[model samples]
Target: MPPTRPHPRLRYQILREQSPSWKTMGTIAGVIFLTTTPLIRPRGLVGRFPNLHCPSSKFSHCRTTANTATDAPPFQVSAAASSPSSAIDEEKEVTSSGNVGADDLLIVGPGVLGRLVAQKWREEHPGCQIHGQTVTADHHEELNEEGINPCLKGTKTTHKFPYVIFCAPPSRTSDYSADVRMAALNWNGEGSFLFTSSSAPYDCNNNGSCDEDTSVVPIGRNPRTDVLLKAEEVVLEFGGVVLRLAALYTSFMKVDAASLSVAILKKRLRNQILLGCDNHPLSRQEVMDLVTKSGKFSETFEAFTGTNDPLGKRLNNSKTREEIGWEPKYPSFAHFLESL
Candidate 1:
């Protein structure tokens, strides 16, 4: 697992602004990553940390109320919000929400990863309505251009989607678990809900082997990891799936957008936890060697504080592969570079 921090938003902001060249390489590499997944049929897809919304059945004027977790913001709703005629129609729609043919997707966060999922989903299921949710309106225009109906986080609608994916980062909210629970409530349970969590919960600081069964760091030991674990619990309680992602990258790591494909491919997964990473893990020296040899990111090495840098845990997603039937196209960083 990578180092944990109190403020994940700050960390990601710095990473996003690191370099234009790096982002460009990541974008190109991401395309290659998605191509490896097996997409046999059209399934609902919801992505987050960058929510992408697709149209689904409207609410029945009576969304189920859920109890918020401790320290989470209260989730109160007015029961008499809709009129008689609308309520009856919505109730009728809700009754048949179980039908798979009309299922659509909601992506909580539509960042780079979410956008890629939306694009690919559209290619396979052109008639599907995709909706994106964001905290700000900054990217609404872009999302609209991509055929994703963008909406603000607090926006209320009559729609109840079959698939809801919470891909947003914790930095976006003070109480991550509360946000996750709210996203979970948006789903009708006719399909799957997935949360993209980090591998930081694993207690593998020694850079030892880490797998799905690896012991997790004791709760309350690290506030950052605590947030993730709590949020994951919320997802699980709601019968959603969790994907523990390792250091995600295009040029740096092989577990890029492939995880999204797996989510879409396996729609019935519930209360399951899967690890997402390549077969081979590299040390700082090895990573540097590869970059230097490729000459694609030679200048980026200055950002690393080599001698003081901590070792990242070696992640083996063998179980994830067996469980989800996923095999990464680029099984290792070496293979990813060779493709370039």
Candidate 2:
């Protein structure tokens, strides 16, 4: 045999060298071990060196992330005193596209519904403060375009802008209470908190005309209803406006409508007949006439839930009209469906 070659370990060392994260970590750990070796007392002398564990190279990234996280979040922050008024001042410059009201207005809600409502208000009063809230990220661009600043979820603090509309819907049926308390919070307790409860809150039967003063009966233990009631309770206690909208209909019905196309969505009337087919709650022709055409339709028709139950005949919105000057400028159910 030739002269004895070096061991395989020596050949491996000379054959190749490679570097990766683990390799770097190992090298650092070795360096630390070398530097601290002198400080390490013998187990016998120290009684036990179990207290001095190996320095782990794996912690490099953990240490780096920990240090970096100490920095602030990525958002503009102003002191409490300057935040609200500055925002208002900034809005005044940009929101001239519409007529604002004498009293500042703030609307709390999300989705296209919120945007359209803000636009509706702007169209009505260009000077009113049209503050909007968006629960989703993708919606921010559209909201900004509408001159409606977005509120980060669970991060909005009330500024008392004279009017705060609780336009937020309850969480999906899976978990209605998930967002129920949000209504209670945005009220801010300083101004009029407009709680948009549902016409469903009124138990409408076939026999009588439901009015605002009608005593409400507990229909069921539905969380959506409970939240609306809770929100209304909270808002009303503070002298805010409680508008129990009855199938919101106006010229711009597409923006904020319960049903988009009465023709296609007529299937929804399946349950309405259970109350009583005698009452037709269609809103298409009325919606069409108000937004597109006009002056051709005649008469206001009421949508009835078709129930003879004494507890179910209380779904009228006369109070909204009597209290506020706002009126439904569209068709009654019979007039709307007749067109369809």
Best by lDDT: 1
True-structure RMSD for candidate 1: 12.9
Residue 90 Cα positional deviation in candidate 2, in Å, after optimal superposition: 22
Error of 2 at 320 (Å): 3.0
Ten-residue segment with the worst summed lDDT in candidate 1?
A: 51-60
RMSD of 2: 30.7
Query: Could you tell me the lDDT of residue 76 within candidate 2?
Result: 26
| Alpha-carbon lDDT, every model | 0.56, 0.35
For all predictions, the C-alpha RMSD in Å is 12.9, 30.7
Per-residue lDDT of model 2, residues 123-161, tens digit only: 555655666654445666666666676654444342324
